[model samples]
Target: SAENVYKADGTIAKSGKLKTGFTAVIDSRTYVIAVCGDVTGEGNVNSKDVTLLQKYLCDNAELDGAYLKAADFNLDGEADNRDLVLISRQKN
Candidate 1:
């Protein structure tokens, strides 16, 4: 699964093989949970996400920290055309 759990500051809190009843405790703060490529947080990755990534790459839109993390398909700590193409080819 591409799902990722992130803390409020947009850093990954946990990842890989998440199971049911998984839990974590942290100081009072918000968190962002989403799939790696699901930048829109729609619980799935699809063509719409591809479009959003394209927009972000073309400077037609902005991606906040969490969304930027999700859009970095190669997990290389950057979002660019390579990531955009990876997102576009995502099967889910």
Candidate 2:
């Protein structure tokens, strides 16, 4: 069975990253980093959801939704933004 991390809204009660390390099977090729990090699936990555990611890392908080479905910016089962460098690189 799949493991549960957080709730549906955005409250996290755990203190560890979930297991999301797996290569997706692409036809005739292996996709290494095709994981989706949109979290809320709002499209065109924006501040609304980034706030939640910041909250979890900076505020030591947790979102009530599934970590994989929300804050896991890299889809590696962690609320980190390594893939979000562009988010930080852009001028404010």
lDDT string, candidate 1, 20-82, tens digits: 122234454434444578777665778888898889888999997667888887999898889
- Candidate 2 per-residue C-alpha lDDT over 3-55 given as tens digits, one digit per residue, 9 for 90 to 100: 33333234442554332222233454533222244444343346645565566
For model 1, state the Cα shift of residue 12 in Å. Answer: 20
Q: Tell me the TM-score of each prediction against the true structure.
A: 0.65, 0.38
Model-by-model lDDT, in order? Answer: 0.68, 0.43
Candidate 1 lDDT score at position 50:
89
User: Model 2 misses residue 33 by how many Å?
Assistant: 19
Model 2 spans > 4 angstroms off = 1-35, 40-44, 83-92
Clashes of each: 0, 5
Q: What value of lDDT does candidate 2 attain over all alpha carbons?
A: 0.43
